[model samples]
Target chain A: MSVPTIKFYVREGLLPPGELTSPNQASYGETHVQRLRLIRALLDVGGLSVAGIRGVIEAIDDPRRPLHTVLGEAADQVVPRYERGDGSGIAEARKRVAELIEARGWRTYEGSPAAESLATALAALEEVGHGRFAEILDAYADAAERVARVDLEYVAHQVAREELVESVVVGTVIGDAVFAALRRLAHVDASDRVFGETP
Target chain B: MSVPTIKFYVREGLLPPGELTSPNQASYGETHVQRLRLIRALLDVGGLSVAGIRGVIEAIDDPRRPLHTVLGEAADQVVPRYERGDGSGIAEARKRVAELIEARGWRTYEGSPAAESLATALAALEEVGHGRFAEILDAYADAAERVARVDLEYVAHQVAREELVESVVVGTVIGDAVFAALRRLAHVDASDRVFGETP
Candidate 1:
């Protein structure tokens, strides 16, 4: 049966209640229960309304379009940071960032959030005094440029216009999530390193 | 006033109403409202109840206690990838991770949530594939290592141990907020790139 039909059965409580097994009782097996729960989760927690959930369920059931393809498209909506060829000269970009920060009405100083974050991570060194921060930032800048260059080169070579656009959008969204999650993981690892030493 | 006290006032409607001059107002000046909101977010969204939020707030506010120190302590809660030290020894970790995936009843070959996340990343290279969803795990490991190394190398060399912890924690947390805000600046870059004449 179609997802809508299944959803209708669930909504009207026509479907057998989950886990009701006895000598005389109606019950859905694990797969049915799982499908119903998954549908519910997609509707409730995943923030898809009934129709969207049905569409998703339909997509999952249809093998012609892989679940991975659908999910990749879905994941693209929330996080995209990896796509390349988005351009801004370093100086112009820095100036624009400074403006954005100022527009937020935050205090501005050499050590201000404005200068520190807007100015390509030079401030990380400033905390330990200028010399050290500068050295590290220099090293980082070189590595970063290489990464960007390589990223651009790869994009140019591998992707066509349509695929590039999709990758750009999806990559940008997922990439941010990836980075944020990674950063959180980093903090967790640091804690583990400091405390966990049972080798 | 203490955070709890501030929250109590806000909840009780004891605080003066904020000026609606700006679109964003929470019945107090930005700082008070922000402090209250931060406390609330920590308590509510962060899964820390009032008491837990209070502890974190106290740690942040107490001049005697450093923020970075607390972060180092908190960071310990993150799970670690326990493979042989070399990246090459990822096989055992892979097996362990596969077991974890199976235990969770997650499908590895299809577009399961986990696969959607880590599959493309795993497919990037053989080493990456070994651990299945190891890309994220490794990205996190790298970010963790970089941040920790930066934290330790820079922080340890400067400041007393007590001061170092506070500064590092504050710096890390604040740096995160700043970095995120700054990264938004990249959108301008992105727009310029997309709209700019083809290079």
Candidate 2:
């Protein structure tokens, strides 16, 4: 980004500019520059507004707290509470899903969406069969929730507040990207597993 | 999303409407409808465009693939290869980060931004001497990568083809949203941890 853009960020309290050397020329150290660039990427590439970016930047700059604390806060911003099935055949589905969550050892709330999605899937599955969909999907949802917790813990270990936020945003998107890429790689692995130059 | 929007999607080949029941009427099954809604959320709310969204949807629709493939590709896209500092003080920082990633047992390519970010952070630590910024972040990255792998495995277990694509889209955005929300909850937990509850 341009120095003027950096200057604007400084003026907006989005960044802290380093000491000025002269009337017009000012020196920027690495953190200042790095923070500036990161903020720009989060704001521009990531499409966050200044205020949202500011909140993230401030969290990153703050040192008194542990990084996980900030990451947990960021995670909360994104996860929605899933509730399942209205009075429509969804009620039975919801119960089965709740059972699945319970079986997985997750504490499902009154109106969690994972539970709800499960319920919806259940209702839909009823059309297919009682035995097939219920047990398997519940297991998957439980696993998904567990994985999410692990993802958070991983965030705690790896990133400061700013990077944590960036990672969650980028990771979630890139996770899908990587998932697709790896799936292709897996095929290559499979093909190699089968016929092509097996080691 | 509105029916017209669904029509627009059908026309765009992003979603295919279900069987036509009469001359002017068509019936969309729950799955088709749900898929369309998920697509709308990703494209509109998540800010993914037609082509970007299409890549994701196509990735999901490919049941023969796993999510790790897609996520790996996405990571490569967003976190591009970055040049390490050339004889600059920043280079020292980069070297340290590379070492740290290696120490953490992560596979660090020489020119990746993730590697560079770690390097830059290490350089900062050299000057700052490890308070808020330190070597622990490398550990966190390692953990984050593991968590991502786990998430991909979970997705792999449950979905493929159109469902895979839909799950990827919803799961990707929702994972971010869920964590962000959880992060908020953690803040509340932090607040409770720090400041006692009101009488």
lDDT of each: 0.38, 0.45
Question: Candidate 1 local accuracy as lDDT?
Answer: 0.38
| TM-score between model 2 and native | 0.49
Point to the candidate with the largest lDDT: 2
TM-score of chain A, every prediction, order shown: 0.31, 0.49
| TM-score for each candidate, following the candidate numbering | 0.39, 0.49
Chain A of candidate 1 gets a TM-score of 0.31
User: How far does residue B102 in candidate 2 sit from its true spot (Å)?
Assistant: 5.2
True contacts kept of each: 0.07, 0.01
Residue-level lDDT tens digits of model 2 in A16-94: 8778899877787877766755564444333456766666556656766455444433332223223322544766656
- C-alpha RMSD of each candidate structure in angstroms: 13.7, 8.7
Most DockQ-accurate candidate: 1
